[model samples]
Target chain A: MDKQEEQFVKAYAPATVANVCCGFDVLGFALDAPGDEVWARKKETPGILISAVTGVEGLSADPTLNVIGVVAQKMLTDLNLEHGLELQLHKGMPVGSGLGSSAASSAAAAFAVNALLGNPFTTQELVVYAMEGERLASGSAHADNVAPSLLGGFVLVRGYDPLDVIPLGVPLDLYASVLYPQIELKTSLSRSILKQEIPLKKGIKQWGNLAGLMAGLLMKDYGLIRRSLHDEIFEPERSVLIPLFKQVKDAALKAGALGCGISGSGPSIFALSPSAEVAHDIKNAMEKVYAGSGIETKSYVSKVPEQGVRLVEQSIYQTV
Target chain B: MDKQEEQFVKAYAPATVANVCCGFDVLGFALDAPGDEVWARKKETPGILISAVTGVEGLSADPTLNVIGVVAQKMLTDLNLEHGLELQLHKGMPVGSGLGSSAASSAAAAFAVNALLGNPFTTQELVVYAMEGERLASGSAHADNVAPSLLGGFVLVRGYDPLDVIPLGVPLDLYASVLYPQIELKTSLSRSILKQEIPLKKGIKQWGNLAGLMAGLLMKDYGLIRRSLHDEIFEPERSVLIPLFKQVKDAALKAGALGCGISGSGPSIFALSPSAEVAHDIKNAMEKVYAGSGIETKSYVSKVPEQGVRLVEQSIYQTV
Candidate 1:
């Protein structure tokens, strides 16, 4: 556990679905699979070095251009640690697919570096560091994705001035089916398309749905959750960017999914179901809509995870 | 209980504080004191009649103009009952005080008439009828006030098209301290001054606070409740209409109140405290702000009530 120990620490961070329908910019939850992994090793040098990047193309090995390097540098600077680190990132999900690709990398890197340094911070304390990576990627530091990827479960980013990230209760029998249409949609472009001003009446309905969703989660009321998973503002405008969005949503609902909506600023669509079987069925139904449309698709059926980034492997005095 | 019985039934409905800061147009909670009462008697005649109206002036006794008569008529027509009714309204609170005065009257009338007709409707089922009275009173059928007044406890109006009124849990020790300034701030005027559209950022914050407040209530987290009781949208525009608004809020917070803000529209201020002693202190502090300012104010310190409109007395075979 010594701070100076020469060791390699590897961690896994899950992909997260942000904005959970009606809870735009405030709510998110982590999925069990399709995550990223980061390996960190304490070095005698005084700066960060990216050893390798794997499982993805067109990514930078330069520390200044990658999310893993950005997150680790921030953590070390904030902790006043002069020790250098070598890091490796392996992307398990598609970048820019709106499944929080950058968030997973940032969370995994923050968690791995923290573990390599003998753990000076709690898991909750790592959120701010991860958000720095999001700022680098999306031009805005939002915690909806990062907090869930770092802390797991459903997280409500109640406020940003003080960064109040609350871990909310989730229903025991909930499952999520996410379908990522293989299309490039920039987060900035998706965000810019949104109306800066929304009708007050629509705002009221959105908040009501958010409250209902929160209550449903705490009480484990599936009917309330289903009723509350509606987005009146974001979906109307953003869904046009994705092909067959309406058709996919309709298929999911018909397959016994509790609710369906775009995930994040999405080319990705997510549906919630009561059980694993329904989630799988929903996934198949969602996929069949895009079959032979000349576009590829990736989908995942996962339970909302209870744990986020964690040290998956550790070896002391390992040579890099 | 028989529908044909010639009986006089009386009901009392507690005053409610709607909006509850960040939950504008969506949330409310009932109070233990300062309410309204209504008496209903089955009549042999074939038309609705208002026998008397007391405790407040400038009110009509006409069946169409009075809220009680309007609500009873709606209930009877909806239930397919040809029976006529005679009603008397007793106002226990000031008119247009922003303490849900009209809602209390509407709720009491609905409860009393339902009882006089042998309880044909459940208390929850009476919210729509009471909302009709609200529409007549404020030109809008908002249920934030009426739901809490009918269902008791903290209530969230999740949606309006379907009229989903969900009763939420209340902390066992929560207390509300309300101060109503005698100055008249019409609900219609206060509502009209609000901007029809709001910035998306502000909307996000408002919903975040609402979610936090809902989580706080369900989990009984006092600190969370205090932190979440903030209004970013309505209070900024509406607080200007109330005299000495900022000073009263400051005094309430300085006196150990958890949170404070304008109640309903304007001219009335409410503060929440953890204990009865602190609530009383907050009430005194709030009242002291208006002392000698030539603005008359009435204050009440009470626990968040568990019961709403209920039958107070039932006399069978009573003459109208």
Candidate 2:
């Protein structure tokens, strides 16, 4: 079938904080600040083509090797679209930063390619295609980052067997204060330090906290969220990789933050605050602690992004 | 202070299905049949007195050792009430059958004593006291059975340190089919076979299913509930202790039951269905499978009880 008209689509997928302390590989939410954008155009040819790539340093231009390229190719193949597509990958966040950099790129590509193909699949299908890209990078088909990055807001990866991702209702006033220290922490290296087996006692605590955290968000109980934002299973073992992790977390709590812990597998750490004002205060407190340790830090304070991946209009050309 | 009234208070606490497949130690729901009833009366004396114990075989009448007595004593000490209370413990369920028999008695005692003292504590506080009773029986402070028994519905044990029990909204049409195999399977013996360490992969699957189950109940998604009811962590090992466990579970599923697995530790097995008719049908299917294995089984089919523990009028004396 010959395509009558060609369409250009630009979409953005927000960065996400996966794991969310006690939730481990189950919970994540999109962030407002850093994200990836993909530009796609319909072509007469029958295969996905990589047109351009920019923003991130030291990345291969090969579509087969790139996150966005890999996700776009999978979507095209799965949908069996008659029209070929070309994609441009643009990264706004640094790679391997624990802030879901690859997920953002994959999500943006999936969202853009779907739009370019007239959105033949549901958002969940798009998430699955994006997860394939995540699998390419992580070697495991985990959806903690990809689901939230594609769906926006807080997403609970209920089960991966059939790929169930449920969006959770979050407190609108709640804010996150994230600090990305100027250091490289590859997810593989961070994951390597983790024990394959978690103590049953700690596992109980982690799941309890996970449930409590969900209840807290749904009921808008800040105190419960604060108390429940503890990770006995993963954080204690993984935080050893980050310098002054305990001090930074303590400073955030001392500074009136509800809770503080590692952001995914990290050199990045985050704290939860009830208000934007408190989130900024918590960011400053975290920065101060990191500054004391002579580690340069970049911080962000934003509410949970309600939209995951969205089409960008020409009017927004000034923004991204 | 002398009591102004010597009023009588009798309450019934429903039996519970704890563990709930993947949510071992953290989730449970009350069943409609086979529960414990406690009769309480205000006394001028300053301590708790156990007047009678019946129904369950081989249980000590000692207040300190018995679950009902232990829970009643804790409630009295916690409240510091001047008036003494006398309790008559009647167990309607079999002991060591893995049907939360002890939890029912403990919950009934807690609910009755609180009513006898004019409701000094909230229902959640009552759950904590009942959990203390469970600790006396299991040597662990687990709220899986006691919380749902006392609260009467699906309960999430979000945390046990300060004892946070959240009552969840359940599907009103959901029905449970439970079968007790008339065999003794002590909770301790069942628990002893479990590995202290679970592979992180299995742990991920377990928590995912737990979150999925909660989402299913909240969203009223039956398929999600069925898919999420799997248990990869505890059931594989514990099921070895129960004869014909696999055949019974498979038969229930074959009869169109949503999901089937061991209810708590075992000797009893349960299957969830979309309706009461299916539940009853599934029960018969399960019974046939057990009968083929030369095992006697008693089956009960009822909706998820919306009420946990409740007061009874004098007209119910014949039932007790």
Candidate 3:
């Protein structure tokens, strides 16, 4: 057997925008900035450990409860590896902010550990490992966030049976404007407020919007994209929790933005525009609306990131 | 003022396959054979009239009760032409056989009337008129059937709010086998059997399949098409009404067919194959199973038609 190559590795996993407009739990894409990083190092012990956690306060140092630690342990157990590892998590994004904070951490740790272990797993397999960590936080294994964070670009979680995710093509001119308000919205809390049963009449329109959205993305038809970026069922229910939701959306639409809706669940609203200039304009418009509410907001305008999780640093030890 | 151009116009509207697998109420495609035709003649009388109905026995002679008459009345009132027209109904497909029999008749009448009026209406507008005719027969103004029959080829009824129907590209090698059993199934009765509320879990999978189906058609990925042609919500409820539904579907899949399911509602089953040879094999397999049940069945294999409704003949008279 070949000796272990990398003694230490660091990886970055970008934050994701899940449920893009009408897609609900089926579509998501990764962002270029405001992500999470993890640095992993080999240890002599047989159990995985989290030696440090940074950027996010009140994070648990106990490996059993931490997302990075949980996912690393699962990967090692699956591969039947006896080597131990220590993970240092640096959270650049806010927690409980609908920015996929937990998913970024889980994806980074899975990716960093896999790189440290000579890249033993495929990217898809790493997604499963990251999903294990996501289940630690959301109580369910949903690939919407982790898939994009692992696979990069726009990703569709086509089916859960056998875990199939298809990478979708993005239009060249598409840009995103994300605004994270200073309020905390837990993923589980936002998910809990959604209705379990929607009326059958609305379901037909939702499916149509979804199909139209996919076609629009593939065909690069901006008019169809503008018309189809509507979620009649879930958006109405979730937007009720956010203050001034309709006004913000209307402002974004009035500023030449193609479509505007919630990013994942709530508070962090995203607007998709045809150009980066328009995306910045949307960001400014969104900031103006939140200015009067005494709510401090952080905003970003970015393109869809081309790569997902990748090793930033690696040191391979060659066997003689 | 321009003199009347077309005194008599005859048009043909092809049969359609509605609710293609997972896209219930949202997707359909037109077939080339076994359709309905209508002949319209402008008259000096004040009211729209059905002069004669043929090709289907026991069809109503009343203009209001018939699909052609109702649609023509709606069109004349909307246009305010201050003229009357006579329509002859010719039904080539079986009634209540789940092969979009009513939509073919409705589309032919709508197209014939529009052509008689010098084609004032756009094709999309004609879809709306065809939908009116469909309402008379199915009790619901759904465009899944009418849109495909009016516009031709694979079509997606993206939304009904502003009445949007998108014509999707079809793969060149895709062929369909449609089998109509000698049994009647009412649209209303079949619709009534469906549950008003579906579980949220199934809703996600259904939307994924729908999005996947659209991508599959646009990309012409047959493997993706085979995987995505599954309806988790309506098909399970509606397929129970058909006899030997499971056996027929299994047999088709076993014979190298891509996918098989009830065409629209029940009493007609359709299978999609990658080749004409395999489509005929599926037809034979389906016929073999139904032969023992003592139910006479008729089948057809055809390509997705490129055109929808078209003028078969027209005679214009000019006044100097």
Best by lDDT: 1
Give a tens-digit lDDT track for model 1, residues B164-282.
98998565578999999999888888989999999999999999999999988987888888889999999999999999999999999999987898888867899999999999999
TM-score list, all predictions: 0.97, 0.92, 0.93
Interface RMSD of each: 0.6, 1.4, 0.8
Compute the lDDT of residue A23 as modeled in candidate 1. Answer: 93
Worst 10 residues of 2 chain B by lDDT: B311-320
What's the DockQ for every one of the candidates?
0.88, 0.58, 0.75
Of 1 and 3, the candidate ahead on DockQ is: 1
**Which order, best to worst by lDDT?**
1, 3, 2
Sorted on TM-score, highest at the top, how do the candidates line up? 1, 3, 2
Q: Model 3 segments beyond 4 Å from truth? A: A1-7, A315-320, B1-7, B313-320
Best by DockQ: 1
* Model 3 chain B poorest ten-residue lDDT run: B1-10
Q: Model 3 chain B, TM?
A: 0.95
DockQ (C-alpha) of model 1? 0.88
Quote model 3's TM-score.
Answer: 0.93
Tell me the tens digit of each residue's lDDT in model 2 across B257-319.
888889989889999998888998999998888776667788898789788888874221222
- Scored by lDDT, model 1 comes in at 0.90
